[model samples]
Target chain A: MSQHISFVQREELKNKPSSDALGFGVHYTDHMFVMDYEEEQGWHDPRIIPYGPLTMDPAAMVFHYGQAIFEGLKAYTTPDGTVQLFRPDRNMKRFNQSCERLHIPTIDEDFLLNAIQQLLLKEKDWIPTEEGTSLYIRPYVFATEPFIGVRPSKQYKLLVILSPVGSYYGDQLSPVPIYVEEKYIRASVGGVGEVKTAGNYAASMKAQKEAEAKGYSQILWLDSKENKYVEEVGSMNIFFKINGEVVTPELSGSILNGVTRNSVIELLNYWGIPVREEKISIQEIFDAHARGELEEVFGAGTAVVISPVGELTWKDQTIQVNDKNIGPLSQRLYDTITGIQFGKTEDEFNWTVQVDEVRV
Target chain B: MSQHISFVQREELKNKPSSDALGFGVHYTDHMFVMDYEEEQGWHDPRIIPYGPLTMDPAAMVFHYGQAIFEGLKAYTTPDGTVQLFRPDRNMKRFNQSCERLHIPTIDEDFLLNAIQQLLLKEKDWIPTEEGTSLYIRPYVFATEPFIGVRPSKQYKLLVILSPVGSYYGDQLSPVPIYVEEKYIRASVGGVGEVKTAGNYAASMKAQKEAEAKGYSQILWLDSKENKYVEEVGSMNIFFKINGEVVTPELSGSILNGVTRNSVIELLNYWGIPVREEKISIQEIFDAHARGELEEVFGAGTAVVISPVGELTWKDQTIQVNDKNIGPLSQRLYDTITGIQFGKTEDEFNWTVQVDEVRV
Candidate 1:
């Protein structure tokens, strides 16, 4: 590493063999990566600093205007003790896409990947060796400008933080139940729906809570204009299998173009599974379920590689998919992706990024 | 005032003169009021401290989840130098209403009002004495929890920041041109649109930018579901006069429940002006303009008491309202409200709150 890029080490952590107990975003690592962007100097001061509080002006644009975007991926410690990341280039591309949408300045992909690899290599011990356990990495950028104008902020700050996360499924992998939200729409066409911005998630909290209150795991958002077509589940892209053909929502301006969603499409294409992206209305899904044509339904995201949907409740009607278990395609996609990520499979796509040598 | 409840006096800013140049939300006084709340204990440790940066965890829920709400009102320095606020109790009530929607714990109205009054008193000299200027006060509450959960945060912070502001109309109160946005929607029914949350404003930035790019002062948002009904203009509630009837978009769950909107309703009622809060579709407004029924259009908000809509461009059609000037009723309502605010008229509705003396 270059002397200028060197970070002061301040290890303050207890070694915990609690990978099995890791929940999503609950337990963080000891160190975090940071880089400051000044208006005159561009992005600079990149360093891996100890995780702590950040002092900010109360009038910072991010607090008042919600000009923030984030990316999510994981670092996996393979069975052979090598730490690797899955398709980080895809994430960096999507991160820049989100930046373009949110008006945040873009960071160079090589620099971001280099910084992340450096940090991960130093903290490789935080990556869980157990299956379905990994070091979840969150790279986010936000407007740091102190002005209170409604315009896009000029100054921004980018930071990366890591958390050791367990399987999205606590102990066993089972399909989850979801509620159909017809009244609340997460995003609309021409809106910032495709971006992984803070505002998009903040807007969905109420709907998520309402679904959870009614004993549902997630919410299935519909298109804002018509409230008829299926858009996306919060934080995940959904897919349905009907008549042995896979159908996912089209990349309308309002739905997130997820990295995992794209990966699933590639995997399905490789397996010669017919996949279509078009407007699939709620009524059509219900009709497919009634005729027993809907064989399976699943949600795709980084956290849960492929979350099969067991049941969907819309209005007063509830539709159950085939066999409350991971479907054949879903299982295969998860295995293939995970295998590649853990360096256990052929590097056909060259998706894995190996970390450099460093001690925690 | 009790010494325990008072803020330490920082008299460095006592010599600043009130001018129209001291515009809205720009110039701050020396001190601010704050209170903290934890799940273990409700709101406590109320203090008036020097205005400065706040130390926050990078993972604080507000930055990530947009769990924040705020209210805006002004402290007017009357012709006789007596400081007063217009309908502060209404703002306090609305502030709590916004809190309930965002799941931020509420504070007692009396305590909040008293704290604001004390703060205003300390900075009474900062209240602009210019004809259209006032001291803008922003009271906000945000999630302070340092976790990445989607649920409502357990810890919260409430703060009141004051800034001396001049008239929103720079140099002149001229009518502004607006562009109707047919593509993007600001808020939707069953969403947090009615609540003055940060997400609502954040969501409007793109639309506003698009409008600004087209040389329009602000964007006129339409209903998300149909994109046909007139919802509200950016940061303001809209009013339309068609065929001698005063009509405003009803309190659809999507539009904000603006304090100025409510005040206009009451004033129209007091003046025996026939008013209706029914759906005002864009088609109806355009048809009315074609038939010479659309007489006047204006916007109401705290910043600008009444901003007349000069012209509206919807798609390819452009419609002019009364040669882009303030209408008769618009002028009367603006005068009445500002008259009452500046103590130039009788306090018939008892809507003003007198500032308490700052004891230091």
Candidate 2:
């Protein structure tokens, strides 16, 4: 898979911007890598074309049945002006996991990694130099077959697009408030909860909007079954520190196996911090709060390394943690992860993939 | 809403041979109805346009976040040369319910119905006159905003595409074999199980495929929490006849309020059948089967109306229903529902909506 390399030169960008303001996903870099998979062709037509709109049939399976999967990672411009990706192998593995669940064709890991590296190299200038900014890479696969059937699609399109993103924490890394929803479940067992598919996030928007309407930053999703155990915070995995031990929900098939969540587990283990991946019920956390054993609570994801859980509102109960400020563990975890990503710390795990320079 | 009428001429369709072979969703009608919604403009630009590809941004909310909702109904041509829709108002109301759950704006029921009628009148010829054949109408909405942020899209596009469909049950309406999955759940109690959202269907595809691999036609889902209570099949609502009583799962938040399910209840009530909506535990079902009290089991939806459940395999215990054929109640229900739909019987419930011919 690594030996087979097919690269297509993209037409020059028609309207390249200089010094543009950083917006979320509004702007795209010069090129996008695309690959098509048909039952007959078996993953052919690999090309890198100029970033533009994709023409898709109205009855495409992705549009109607939501047979779509996506992955998110970032390319950082380090202090020494070199572009690098953090733990792209993890993203690739998770991407394949998503493909398997959605019945989409899985690409060779080496091929995907090499293609993304080449794409980033071609559009390296898009990586932001600002301290808290980077180029966000989006890899998505969807059913492109023009059919109205509710079955697995035979045709698929895989694409990778790049967008420069500003700081996800906004201006300051302030602790954010999250509303606890006992009524809505984000994912469930036997469902595509562990997969990074589009439906999980789409199903969460209504509850999220309700949380925002109630003056909260995000929604903390509870387990669907009993609604007693803590699941996730939509886009991120959660952590609760009680009795000086870090506790997060075990992979119950209803919560995403986030990359950042895995990183935190490894980092905590390396730092000799006790971390337990077991069921953490809401009552236990409240009980721990009553006993002064609840130390800190935070969320981990690719966007934000660790967002401190400032306050929680669940069923007429409000629990505040660490006086609305980032806790020691949260700060340490964020610094360690970002430090490794930006090349400030030693790459003991060798997670960074160096982007080769391309001569213009 | 009725005063605001915007129309586009229907484009001519290419004629295909009668024996062209019909696949599930492969072929589509020539024209499609589209409308846009925004915060500033409530609902505008309603028109029928040539069916073709849609140009969407790579980062559109629907592509990445899965913020999509849809409804499925059909236009049937009666023997009297009139085109009609079966329980379209129910579909419209359910469509709004789905929209509310997804945070998408709702359209006026009358306006949507009028638009659909106009569109169907133009494409009346596309409706097949063959027995058990009709034009499947699909109305779907998606987030069109190109943003990477995790929020509801302010801009949305609603479109209706029509496809000619044959009988879901082939020549002989044979009862289907189902796999009862106790390990996986199709939906959780507080999830988007009730809404006709794409995410719910997306979540069920894996389980459906697994059941198919086991030589079963569908999967019988269990409650997400304990996997104790029987919920529903992915595409249709399930019902059981035990001890001379019609029993179905109650309207739990995790189950869809299917229009077909409701109509069956009404028809049963009119026919003096004792129907009850309650939590029917899997254990109870199995016990009844063992006691020879379980008379029949069938699924109900718009596509098939009523499909009998012949055999169910649950945890190494395969239970075959009486005689492995359609039960008396199922056959009668199917006859009554399709009779009303095709204008072969009295429209006691006034479920049919007539499409008047217009000189354009």
Best candidate (score: TM-score): 2
DockQ of each: 0.51, 0.77
True contacts kept of each: 0.46, 0.82
Q: Per-prediction RMSD in angstroms?
A: 3.0, 2.1
lDDT of candidate 2 over A1-360, digit per residue (tens): 544435655656545443346767768887889889899978877777777799989998887888889999998777778888899998999999998887778999878888888888778767777777888999989888888778888899999999888777755567889898977888877778888989888888889988888999888888776788888986999999888899999998878898899999998998899999998888898888889888899999998878999998889998898888889999888888888887788878787888878222
For residues B123-211, could you state the per-residue lDDT of candidate 2 as single tens digits? 77678777777788999999888887788888889999988888777554679999998766778877788888886776677778888
lDDT of 1 by residue, A117-152 (tens): 888876777888777788889888887787665677
Model 1 chain A: ten consecutive residues of lowest lDDT: A1-10
Name the best candidate (by DockQ).
2
Name the top lDDT candidate.
Answer: 2
> Can you tell me the CAPRI class of model 2?
medium
